[model samples]
Target: MSQFAGLAVELEESGVKHEMITYSGAPHAFTVFGSDRYREDADKKSWMAFTGFLEEKTGVKAM
Candidate 1:
């Protein structure tokens, strides 16, 4: 996690656009279906974040 934070900081320092969204206590594969660790809220949140990121970079809203 520190590495990710460091990367985010580095990106900011280098003037690159970036965003980070962390789901606290979300286990691995939290977005995968049929997994015991799957979380509906986290899955939805992750997809929304991903779509938003894509839209923010590409200027096209996802359907």
Candidate 2:
């Protein structure tokens, strides 16, 4: 999580709005389709968070 933490700090210093999520026990590429580490809960959570972030940045609601 050090990498994520460093990025978060950089984003904070840059004053950019962002979101970071860390799913415990989730491997890299957990969201990749057909991967053994794919997690439904993580996918759903990340999707919603991403959509919300997009909506915030673009001022366009996701359908």
Candidate 3:
């Protein structure tokens, strides 16, 4: 199994609520919008995922 799959298995065994995402070709710092390493697709997707998680868990909508 792939690394992410293995991690999913581990999380399942540990009974933890979790989510996993991978950016296929995104470089490091992909979330830093103005940085040279930024990747627009990954950044936007990740930000949306992050905000969704935050709102779900804390009930605070992202601005």
Among the numbered candidates, top lDDT falls to: 1
Ranking by TM-score: 3, 1, 2
Is 1 or 3 the stronger prediction by lDDT?
Answer: 1
Which lDDT tens digits does candidate 2 get at residues 1-63? 888899999999999987677978787877988889898788888888889989998999998
**Candidate 1 runs further than 4 Å off:** 1-17
Give candidate 3 regions above 4 Å deviation.
33-36
| Backbone atom clashes (below 3 Å) for every candidate | 0, 0, 0
Candidate 3 residue lDDT tens string, 2-53 = 8779999999999999877888789778878688898998988888999999
In candidate 3, residue 20 scores what lDDT?
78
Q: Write the per-residue lDDT of candidate 1 for residues 1-63, one digit (tens) a residue.
A: 898799999999999976677898788789889988999998998999889989998999999
Please report the TM-score between candidate 3 and the true structure: 0.70
- Clashing residue pairs in candidate 1, if any? none
For all candidates in order, the CA lDDT equals 0.88, 0.87, 0.87
Q: Which stretches of candidate 2 lie over 4 Å from their true place?
A: 6-18
- 1 versus 3: better TM-score goes to: 3
- With candidate 3 superimposed using the best TM-score fit, by how many Å does residue 46's alpha carbon deviate from the native? 0.6
Worst 10 residues of 3 by lDDT: 24-33
